[model samples]
Target: MNASAPQQSNSTPLCYSINSPPFTYNHPIASAYYSSIFTLLGLPSNLIAFIVLIKSFKEARSRSRSFFLIFLGGLVVTDFMGLLVTGCITVSFHITHFNWRNLDPHCHFCNFMGMSMVFYGLCPLMLGAAMAVERFTGINCPFTRTSSQTKGRPISMVLLVWFTAGCVALLPLMGVGGYHIQKPGSWCFFLISYKGNDQIFSLIFSVVGLTSIAVSFLLNTVSVVTLIRVCCGQDRTQRRRDHEVEMMVQLILIMVIASICWCPLLIFIAQTVLSEADLQVRYLLLWLRFATWNQILDPWVYILFRRSVLRRISPRSDWSRSSIMTLYPTLRETIRRLTSSSLELGEMDEMGKSNVTAPPTLKP
Candidate 1:
C-alpha cells in the first residue's frame, strides 16, 4: 500500500512519493463527465427529499411520525453532504490532477478525504439499520416504542450513529487503522490488508457494514410481513391504514437499495482481508461505484413515493376500498405473500394515526 511501491493493478497513481513532475488529468473528459453526472443526479434528488421531509415534519400530527421523520431527514442530510463533499473533491482531482504529495504534504488533506469517504459511506447504512429498529419496535410494541415518546430520543439516535461512524473513520488517526492513497490517486480509502492494525480495521469495517445491512434486512422483513398480515388478514384493523405506511414503504426501499449497493464492497473487504489475496484495486473501485448508486437511488424513494406523488402516479390507487392497492398490485401481493407468510407473526410500527384512509373496518 506504500506509494513508492509498484501497485499490482492497472491503476495509475496521480503522483509518486519520489520526485516527479506535477500531475495532470489522466482521463480528463471521462472523469469530469462521469463525476458531473453523479453530482447532478445526486444533488437534486437529495434536495427534493430534504424539501419533502421538511414539509412532512411540519405537518406530522403525531410524535411518532415526527420521530421517524427525523431519521429520514438524517439520511437525506448524510447523503446530500456525502455527494457534495466527495463529488467536489473527486471532480477537482479529475480536472486538475493535483499532485497528492505536493498538495497534501503532511497527508492531512488525504486523511481528511479518507475520513470523509468512510464517514459518509457508513453513515447511511447505520442510519438505515437504526430506522429499521425504530420501525420494528413501533409496530411490535407500539406502547413501549419510547423512541417517539420524547422528541430528544430520535434526534439522539441520529447523533449517536453519526458519532459512531465518525469515530470509526478517525481510527486511522488513532493508529488502529490506516488510510492510503488508492487506485487512480483521485480518492483515498482504507486499503484491504492483512497487516496488524489494518487487518483489524478492515475486519471491523466489514463486520459493521455487513451487520448493519443484515439487521436492516431482517427487521424490515419482519415489520413488513407483520403489517401485511394485520392489514390483509381476516382481522384487518386501523394499523393497516395508519400513516406509518408511508414510512414503511420508504424504509423497505431504503433497505433494498442499501443491501444491493453495499453488500459487494463489504463482502469483498472481508473476503480479501481474510484470504490474504492480493488486493484488486479494480474490483474495489467497481464495488465503490456500486455503493455510490445508493446516494442517487435513496432520495428518489422520498421524492417519488410521496402520497401526493403516488396519487398522481396512479390516481386509481386506494387503501380502504382495496387491500393496500398500489399501481403494481400484483407485485405488492407477491411480496406480501413472500414476506407475510414466510415470517412468523410480528407487529407494525404505530408511528402515527391514519393518513391514508378514512377508516378501515376494525375488529371489536
Candidate 2:
C-alpha cells in the first residue's frame, strides 16, 4: 500500500522512520468542498421536508397516506442525523487537518464514529426496504383486512428497524467484527483490511443492503405492471388510473436513484474484502462521497413528488403553466389528475356497486 520508497539513507533524521509513508490528504480538497456544500444544502431542506411530513401525517385521511408519511418522516430524520454526525466530523477533520487514525488508541471518538457510521448508514437503507415491503404486500397483494393493519404498525416497524440497525452497529464493539479508521482518517467503518468476522459482517451488510434495493426495484416493477393491467383490462371503461401510476412511477424512480448512489460503494467494499486488493485511498473516498449523496438527494425526491407542495408552488399564470406543460408534461398531467374530483366519484361508484351486488333479505 506504500507508494513511497521503503529504503532511505542513514543520514535521514533520527525522529523520522524510514519505513513511514508520506502523509497525504484523502482527496482533501474535493471532500471538504463537496461535504461542506452538501451539508449546507441538505440540512435546511431535510428539516423543512420533515416539518412538511409531520403536517402531512396530521392531515392524513387514508391508510396509504399514513404509511408513506411515517416512512418518509423516518427517512428524513435519518438523513438529518447522518449529515449532523458524519458531515460535521468530516468537514471538521478536513478543515483542521486532524488525522483520526493518529489519535490515541483508547479515544472514544473512534468508537463514536464507527457506531454512528453503521447505525445512520444502515438506518435509511433498511427503512426504505421496509417501506417497499409494506407497499408491496399491503397494496399489491390480495388479502382481507386484518388486525395487523392498526395505526401502531408504523411505529412498531420504525422501532424494529432501529433496533436491528443498533444491533449491527454494536457488533464491532462486541468483538464479533472490527471497526477501523478508513481512508483519509476522518471516518471509521467496518474494517475492510481483514478477514474474519469483520469481513463476514461487511459482506452481510453489502448483500443485505443491495438485495433490499434490488427487491424494491423488482416489487415496484411488478406493482406498476399490475396497475397497468387493471387499467387496461377490467377497469378499461373507468377513468384513467394516472394518479396511481404516477405515484408508483415516482416510487420506482426514488428507489433507482438510491440504488445508484449507494450500490457502487457497497460493491467496492465487498470486492475489497474478497480480493484483498490495495486500492488508492482517494478512489475509495470518492466513492464514499457518492454514497453520501443519497442523504442529500432523498428529501428533494419527496418534495418534488409531493402533490400538495407542488400545488402551492406552481404558478397560475398562463405562461408558467404552458412552460410547465412543455417541460414536464407528465408532471403537469399528474397534478391535474391529482386535483380532479372524478377519481373520488369513481371510488364511490365502485363501493356502491359492491353493496348492490350483495344478497338481500337473508332469513335468520
Give the clash count for each candidate: 3, 0
How does candidate 2 fare on TM-score? 0.75
Best-fitting candidate, scored by TM-score: 1
Instruction: Kindly list the per-residue Cα lDDT of model 1 for residues 1-364, writing each as its tens digit.
Output: 3332333452343223222334342543335676778888999999998998999899998876888889999999999999999899888987887878778755677777889999999999999999999999888777786543687888999999999999999887777766677757777777678877789999989999999999998998898888866665554345444567778998999999999999999999999999999887667877888899999999998888777787777777684344454545786687678667545333233323333456668879
- Which candidate comes out best when scored by lDDT? 1
Clashing pairs in 2: none
257-277 in candidate 2: lDDT tens per residue?
789888888888888878878
Please list the residue runs of candidate 1 whose C-alpha ends up more than 4 Å from where it truly belongs after superposition: 1-30, 146-148, 236-240, 319-364
